[model samples]
Structures are given as C-alpha cells and as structure tokens.
Target: MGFSVRALDTDSWAAFAELVEANNGVWGGCWCMGFHVKLGKGRTAQQNREEKEARVQTGDTHAALVFEAEKCLGWCQFGSPDELPEVKSRRLYEKGLTTLPDWRITCFFTGKGFRGRGVADAALGGALAQIAQYGGGVVEGYPEETDDRKVSGSFLHTGPMSAFENHGFTRTRPISPHRWVVTRTV
Candidate 1:
C-alpha cells in the first residue's frame, strides 16, 4: 500500500488530531512544536500546542502532515527557517547553513503498526515534494541512529539516520555518534 503526505491545515485537522491521539501522546500533545518553542527556552506543553495550532491556523508554511488513506501515518514539521530555534542554535548548523529560504523537517512520528514499513520514508519524500511546491529547495533533517540499542519511537521522533539517508540526504556533520544533521537538495 502507498501513503500520501500533505500539510496539516484546517482541512487536515481531524486526521491530524487522530494521528496525534493514536501515537499515545508521545509528544505530550505537542503537535510537533518542541523545536518551535525555541532552544534554551522553556514553555508549558499547552503553550507549545497552542502556539503550533496558531501557526497552522495562520498558515505558517513550516508545518506539515502525511496520510495513508483515512489514516495519517507520518508528519514532518518544516518551513520557518529563522523561526526554528533548535536548528538555529546548533553550532554545527550555524557554520555553513544555507541562507536561501529552506524548510526544516524537525520531527516525525509513524503509527505503531505502520512503523518499520517505509512509512516515514514515503512521507519524507512527499514532504520534499511539498517543500519544492512551496518554493523551498533545501529540506533539512536531524535524526538519531543506533546499531542495536532500543529506544522508544517517541525518543526517536527526530527520526533515524537510515530513514533520511535512504531518502537521499547527505550527512552534513556528526553532532554525535548517534545524532547527525542530514540534508537533501531538491
């Protein structure tokens, strides 16, 4: 089966909501706003969710979601280059990040039964397409990977190295052995 990706706008509210709920609130009802809350800064869970929802309502181009049939299988939060404090604060990212307008795939979450089945890969590819359609050429991602260690998908919501690499992202730098910034130019 194939999955489709789309923006989490007003039309996708129900699907998006369902997607979040089905994930056991792994993101603390974040709506994927952890990076949007600013690095080195703090905000309540409700605050993050509210801010994210407001951005979506105002048509902030940085937010997105992916769906497979009636089920939303994946999400890649992107757009808003200057607005994403997490990526902006990274020293490695600070050094040679593109000045051109870009989209940041800050986070992802795949449904339980649909995981490890290429769902995130499809969603990310679709996200790259959406980024291009939105006039974005540089799509960025920061993902974590491990050889055999076990971790919850919630903890790995930033995604994994294999996922982005399989999608043609080049490793720009290694933030750590397990974490790296990977990017794909489209």
Candidate 2:
C-alpha cells in the first residue's frame, strides 16, 4: 500500500485534524504541539487545536502529512528551531547541543491499525523531500532506539531511531538512554 505526502497547511488542516481527532487529539490532546510551544497550566485540548490551526493558517508550522487516498494515515512534523523550541529532554539536548540545525523533526504519528506498515518511513521521506523543497539544509531528529525491546506504539511519537538511520541520518549522540540525536545533511 502506497501513501501520498502533503504539507500541513490550511488546505490540509481538516485532514490532519481528522487523524488527530480519531486518535483522541493525539498525546492527550497535544495536536502535535509538544514541540511548538509550552502548553502550560490552563491549556485545554480545544486550545491546542485552535492554536495549531492558527499556526497553520499563518504558516508558523510545518509537517509532512501522509494520506492513503484522502484519509490521513499520519504525519511527521518538522520546523525551524524558533518555530519549535520546546523539545523533549531539553536539558540533555542543550547540554550536547553546540548549535541548532536548519530544521528539526520533532513529532510523528502513524494512525491506529497502520502501525509498523511503513507509514513512518513514508512520512519521514516526505518530510525530507519537503525540507529540500524549502531549501535543503542540515536536519536533526530525536528518536528512540527500539533495537530489542518492545515499546508501546503510543510512546513512540518521536519515531524510532532505526527509521532515521534508514533515511540516511547518522547517530550524533545519545541524549538519554535509548534515545539519540540523529542528523542528516538532507
């Protein structure tokens, strides 16, 4: 089964929302906003949805959304450091971070019933293609390594390290146990 990729913008917001909504707003209503901004106290699912839509409307966010004939399969969110400043393991990442890359791949989602079907690979490939279209540069991704362990799909939102390696990203350093910073020139 092949899937097509599209940029996340006003035109594809509905489809993106559909995927997230079907998954109960994703990450407990994160809407994949975990990297974009800090959803502090008083943040609601509706707020996240609205904020994400607002960002999409103003071109403040970017992602490669995968679809199988109009139904969204999943997405891989990528953006500039400024666009997405709040990353997981912030302290550890900053400790090893010398400089920021041109782009950062922070989030990914492979819809329910579609896990392990290469959706992540497709979404990742699509993201790189889109980044190239936006002017290729150094790209970085933080992914967990699931070499011989069973990790719940729900917790692998940042994607698997193996996928990044398959996409030409070399391991840079380990930020946490089982998680590494992967980089590619793109």
TM-score of each: 0.82, 0.97
Instruction: For residue 78, give model 1's deviation from the true position in Å.
Output: 1.2
Candidate 2's displacement at residue 75, Å, is 0.4
lDDT of 2 at 90: 84
Query: Which 10-residue window of candidate 1 scores lowest in summed lDDT?
Result: 37-46
- Kindly report which residue stretches of model 2 are placed more than 4 angstroms away from their true locations once superposed: none
User: Model 1, 1-186: lDDT tens per residue?
Assistant: 666777778788678767766775545566676676652346665565567668778876354466777778777767656666665337766665556336678877786777887777776777787777877677778888766798767657788788788888898877656777777777
Model 1, position 186, has a per-residue lDDT of 76
Candidate 1 — what's its lDDT? 0.70
Candidate 1 wrong stretches, greater than 4 Å: 39-42, 61-64, 88-92, 95-101, 148-151
Cα lDDT computed for each candidate against the true fold: 0.70, 0.91
Q: Highest TM-score: give the candidate number.
A: 2
